[model samples]
Target: MNTNTACELKWGMLCAALIFLLLGACSDKDAIDTRPSYDPSKPVTISRFAPDSGGVNTQMIIYGSNFGSDTSQIKVYINGHLARLIGVNGTALYVLVPSKAGTGEVKVVIGNPAKEVVAAGPFKYIFLPSVSTLAGFTDKDGRTAIVDGPIEKAQFEEPYWLCFDEKKNIYVLEEFRGMRFIDADKTQVSTRFRTGNGLDRPRTLSFNTTYDTLYITNDQGSWTGLSTAVATKADNFTRWTSLIYSLQTNGGAAQPQTGDYFYNSYSNGAIFKWDRVAKVSKELFRIGDVSWEFNIQFAPSGDFAYIVVVNQHYILKANFNRETRQLETPVHFVGGRRSAGYQDGVGIDARFDQPHQGAFDENDNFYVCDIFNHCIRKITPEGVVSTFAGRPRTYGYADGALRDAQFDRPMGIIYDKESGTFYVADQKNRRIRIISTE
Candidate 1:
């Protein structure tokens, strides 16, 4: 037991201690990783969604995070519902929280993976109440209204169409987002209607006042993500072409987008009309492959209709009395080139590069939002077109007026007929304009 044996014993003891220490370190690290980290310095900072602002989708100027970095598919949750969390950063995420509910609170739950909610809390205050429709499409006069939707005087992301039932409940129809409702006071209304479970592209809502029914059509083009980087696609539109849904309160028929035009991309690319009373549908008319028809309105006459197509495609009109139904043969409601070196030779219609969406101005005229072109066009029923708003440039023009300014993709148009006020969904600009016509 002299020097050699004693030394060996001591060395062996040291090795055992080191092994124990390593094991303890590893155990501690595992526990720490699994522990809850629901704290963030600043959860979400929002300044854009303030009241009286234009419509908002995913393009929110938000600041917050438990988000480490690389936000590809940040599925934010409000309370627990999937509010779209679009672009992301290490400490910030420009997410799309749904239109504010009447009284419910908004909480952010980030879900990119199966990981636990890194952070969840109420967001900036939202007071947007719901609008209900006594009849699906309320067109008393030039003052067209949706009991649960816009009143020809709403703005972007405002419910374009709203419907209601005998119960006095109102339901709203969103472009790519789904349906919501309101009570008598216009508080948020909740229904089973969904937003993006089966949309291939941007969608629209058409109601039949005659039958107390709803018609929803999805384009499938936007969801392809083949468009530009700014085009907003729906999560539900994995491969959806169109959807035909019906809102029959109590116990009514469930309608899916079917038939020749239910979800078909054929016959001039138009959305079909569903007869809620008859439970039958037919091809209403084709709006083409453009994303502009996301917001549609039937004329106060209830006999005519005008729709917009994306990117210089066209803003078309339909004559229900006529036999031949095409894209209503767009008369260049507004047209221009949005991209570099874009050219349309010989024809005025050729110049329209990226026309986003539009709605009707009171006199039954059209307000066509020409995105990237830096202007909106005023079109007549017979196809006479004029610049309605904005000017030539890469940005917005004049403060109150829609002057030349930067616009990514202005998607929705909300109009108020009473004041003759117009709100453009200047998407890229992330702003809404309040324009009045003379």
Candidate 2:
């Protein structure tokens, strides 16, 4: 062949060889080892684990070698249950302890090849004890004791009333402190709101769950909102004593909205419904010649409201017509005449001496703080009255069995459903007393 022809053939051959070499390089790269390999001599090993003991859903870290960074290829088991792997690195893995996992060995599996490694010691699953009853409260040593303070900073000076919101935060009415908010744990305290408007001597607070509004009654005879950001004010009462919100009506144009609230005037013995939207107060009904209304609470059924007649030493169960905004005749449910004594029986047979505040438990059982009698009393849904806490006629700061425990004029009382505990504002003791079976 001519020199030019030979040069062209050589160029084509060189191009073919170049293509073959490129194909080989691509194949080698595609076949590169992606699967992690384990050595029999230097197998996967777990050195230790941080926070080897924790409750369910708690995150823990595992320290080891040959864990491999691929999360999907790794599995972690706490006590036989597979733990959720949150992250994984070559030498460590993070996981959440599985719910219902018991205390046992923690195993880490590296890959489908199944190189398993276990820590030196087993991990522990912490299960919190369940509270069974509200019979009494005790300390770590199992001795009867008060759970909350007399700490100077958290002490209350005549805490008149208290109520819990949906979040379980407590709103307390301190005679001098205006309104204070205590967290569920009671570890932190905060002021719910502050306003230049007279909230002096706030006596009672009622929360409207539907509107998230708080209706407060003070000695100044004014109804105000907890937050100044909201417009809630109704003045001109002789003396506002107790406050509570009406239940929401499902049907009927004439029925009051869920935001409406009611308060009783101590001086006039009149109950007034305050329209939250219109910011107006209208008298609903008046108890004949009755004086010193202390506490008012609506039953969960929303059929009737129980009012404490402080001077009468009885609880009046008043039925209200949501459509007409009128209250029917009130009945003395728990006590009889104005005589003050310590006695437990059915309905009118029971006696109360200066009952202050009242609350209801999950079972609809009504509880009252019989201040003068120095005990907490419970009135069943069937109208059977009994002393639930505090020794009758016994007054001190001692804590023990209901019959042996002494309370110094316990006032504000509230029930916490979350903990199944009753928190009492032991007014004379200047401390909060809790009753529970935790």
Candidate 3:
């Protein structure tokens, strides 16, 4: 009885000890962390972010610590909106703020455990006024809202093209009065100069900020009664008749001295660049076979130039080589289809009748005056075209919503990058019309 009892007791004790050991091992393994734990003491830190205030899609750099080498583990948020992560290192991260992100705190999260670090100061999401549509001249009545001209006198009678300087000063070209200048605040007006020397009609004006020069394109004949004569006399009458005048911010000699200038001949549809210093003129390109080219404009980026073919009722973009000052073959960017109706669509699907001039806004959106349609159309960078202002073929002197506002014939337009405003030459209305955000 004693031997049997002793053996059973020993085996029971051994089995019990084995069970206890097994449970202990399991508890230890459960307590051990397979993944590295974030240290509370060495918490993730975000020191700062560069360009703290920026608009949507702005690239931003964040400086921090413990952000891990793998960018895939890093997630950034600006004002609670997920930002597009571009790159990251252990100490810094590159990200693009989400479009339309509001002003709020910037947060950076790292690791599978998801440790988050917030910036010291809130990141400001700058909001620019979205100008998808036009609101007519911010005045009581459209007809009497000439900021520069006399209340009774139509100082802009036959205003053709207009532009704004960096300081927001305006320069307008008039068929009868030539060039007029208006101050930034619109309180002062000055008649700077007039076109002469057989250039009876000034059609367009271009400002080259790089060279600080003003280029004028003039037609040799009048549009009043010499349409047939202009067609026949074309090249001979308008050849080398354009002017290039040097511009001064202050009141200097703003005269056209006939130096080497670049001009467009509407009669023959030829574009020539003249070097007044060299006394030589070289023909760049011609669209005489297609239609008469009316206006030529260099992109604000200086990467391309757009030419408006009035008779063809379309616009063409020519790739310009800045270093060589040469233009490549032109490509149709907008309004190739010849429908005189007011419709907005994508690229060639949109129709423009007699697109007289074109201008580029801050975001590179191209705006054109659809002369016959009597409206301004905007073409996006992605080739989407839409009517931005004025009613289709509707003429009146009212001021309000762009669709409700009437323009007799808008021939020219220029955008103000600083204020996000557009000054339009309401040709038949005989006044300068303004398009601005509400």
Candidate with maximal lDDT = 2
Q: Which of 1 and 3 is ahead in lDDT?
A: 3
Model 1, total clashes: 41
lDDT tens readout by residue for model 2, 1-438: 999997687556544544533343233555773433334457798898767687665667777777655677788998899998766555667777876688999998776657787888999888652212212233455344222342324545555577776677676666655555677656665555432344444666665545245556555542332211121223211123333322111001111244446666665667666665676657766764634554567776566778787767888887767786555667778886677888999989999998878878878898899998999899998899998888898887676666667788888888866445677877766556777522
User: Pick by TM-score: which candidate is best?
Assistant: 2
lDDT of 3 by residue, 84-114 (tens): 8766555667777776677899998877668
- In candidate 3, list every pair of residues with a backbone clash: 259-276, 260-275, 260-276
Candidate 1 has a TM-score of 0.41
Q: Kindly indicate the candidate among 1 and 2 with the higher TM-score.
A: 2
TM-score of each: 0.41, 0.59, 0.57
RMSD of 2: 20.4
lDDT of 1 by residue, 287-326 (tens): 4443223233456554555544443254444444434322
Query: Each model's RMSD to truth, in Å?
Result: 21.2, 20.4, 22.0
Q: Please give the distance, in angstroms, between residue 391's alpha carbon in candidate 2 and its true position after superposition.
A: 0.9
Candidate rank order under TM-score: 2, 3, 1
